[model samples]
Target: MSDDLKEFESDFATLAKLAVQQSEEDVRLLLGRLVRKYRQRHPELAEQLNLSLKSIQTRSGSGALRRESLSEQAPGAGVPLDRDSRLELLKEFDDRGGMSVPLLPSGLLRQVESIIQERQARETLLARGLAPTRSAILVGPPGLGKTMSARWIASRLGKPLWVLDLTTVMSSMLGKTGANLRAALDYAKRHSAILLLDEIDSIAKRRSDESDIGELKRLVTVILQEVDHWPDTGLLLAATNHPELIDPALWRRFDAELRFSAPDTELTVQAVRRFLGPDTEALGQWIDTIATSLKGRSLSDVERAVTTLRRGHALRHAPDEELVSAMVGADLGMKSKVERLTLAVEMAKAGKHTHQEISRLTGVARDTIRKHAGPSPRRGRGMK
Candidate 1:
């Protein structure tokens, strides 16, 4: 038999297996390739297959393949790339087992958990003639684990996460921009992978803004349509630090909206403890003092500060009290007199430092610390 015939047989065998298993997506994808392959050599056969393919894509209901799934597969079935600069448009991360749930507030954590649970139980929803959440928008200030949360959701579902590399996807030639985005989205849908449009506000600006050009606005239209018809097999996530810049119409399309705020005092303490890692035990005495000082800050900032303290303690053999004191002292300079007094009282109550040390570090009077905290425990009680 000719090599072409052998190839045809193999393709037919795989298609038959996929059909028997009711893998509609795989069947659709294979039929598409066969249609193209036979187009020139056997135009009549190709025409028949093409007609059937179009019918399958446009068929309405729960099991139909999305129209965008008809998009040509990216070369070699790898991540999509810009044709001009060959820059990769989608960055792939397969963290099937390694990713951990990001540190988040209790309320925000529940929202994230629900998203994962819904995706895992997608079949149950389909049975009831309902669709699972196909898309969500993560809105908040930066450095608050929005991206990490996307990773965790994908990890829990046992799927690879494909993050859109906006730097590469945004083309200088505006026409190519839309094409690039569609190609990337189509590829993600084809593989049923989680696709995160990080910093979506960049391209999804308000359409009413008069300064924007026609092509840029067209990008928003492309995204709006994709979000509306996103397949149940894939999860689409968009994250933005500035939600206001996103078009109002685009915002309404997401199935859920997750808001991430700065960590509260209790959450900050938990973040500090987690970030301290192995040194959490060594610096256990100053956890409350550190948490109080770091309150109102983002979790990322807390992690950075804790990491620096851990490094100093490990490398320079710096005492935990001195490191914590220096950090708190630097922060104290920015605080008002009342704020400093409050923090000083907190430090005293922690009983990890004497009144003299707390007053010196926080610039509060020793007498005031004693009056507020009802006197320090003892000299030896504090870190030497």
Candidate 2:
């Protein structure tokens, strides 16, 4: 027998035995999973089998069947599917596999989480004559956590993430882009997947731009219409670096409008501590100094800089002070660095450090300090 036939035989045998011995809950759960996988391999055959299975399941008097019924409602079961579907580049996957979730500020974290958490209570939301916020727009500078949050939602909801890659979705062929978007959204609705229209500003720009084609302007209206009618089960998320470019009407269409920014002090410190790992606890009180030095950088900047430092420190056997200096230097202005170094000299003198120790710590010789702060050196770089 072919491998496909062998696998089918094994699955069917297992399913058959489960039906005879397992409780209804166990049987229904396993049956749904079997059908889900079976649909991928033989959608037409699976659809036929699903109809027969549902007939038998209802006859057995199970009042509500979650997956067994929902799987049939998923895309392409009994419903006519488009032959010329233009959404080939769209990817579908579940979970981020424990990848790093960004440390967002509390306000923004709660905002993003509201949508994610509501998605879990979708049935409750719809049953009460309310719609769970289906669509959202994330506005932020590049390198913030907008994209990461989108993935995190998919993982949390345990739904396939349907990402619409604009480069592939946008086509020069007349009227094709709109069709592609509709088909993608339709798929998301049918599967209850998280649909991410990343970089949405590229198409949903304000209509007044003279350079933009009339069709490009019309796309904004089409997007808004789709959002208005988007289903409660599916989550529609749009991320953009420039929110100002999107049409104003489009702005109000989404239920949530979240603005993301670079990490503040607390979040930056958390990111630093996370990236530093065991080294953070080892540094004791000094970790706070490292966190303060990382204040102005984005989470990505800290990750890359610290990761590089780790590799260099391991290879070069550099001291912890080298890494600290690099992080602190990145956050300070050039003039600030000089001023701090000078201040360090004064601070050391005001304390117990010997002159030579102060010189080494400040990278300033005693004569250099006397020349500048002594009141005998030139008043300015060039002016006397």
In order, how many clashes per candidate? 0, 0
Candidate 1, superposed: residue stretches over 4 Å from native: 1-23, 26-77, 204-211, 333-338, 371-374, 379-384
lDDT on C-alpha atoms for all candidate structures: 0.78, 0.64
Once fitted onto the true fold, the runs of candidate 2 whose alpha carbons sit more than 4 angstroms away are 1-88, 96-101, 171-175, 204-212, 278-286, 330-384
Cα misplacement distance, residue 242 of candidate 2 (Å): 0.8
TM-score for all models, in order of appearance: 0.76, 0.64
lDDT computed for candidate 2: 0.64
RMSD for each of the candidates: 10.4, 13.4
Q: What residue pairs clash in candidate 1, if any at all?
A: none
Top candidate on lDDT is: 1
Please report the candidate that would top TM-score against the real structure: 1
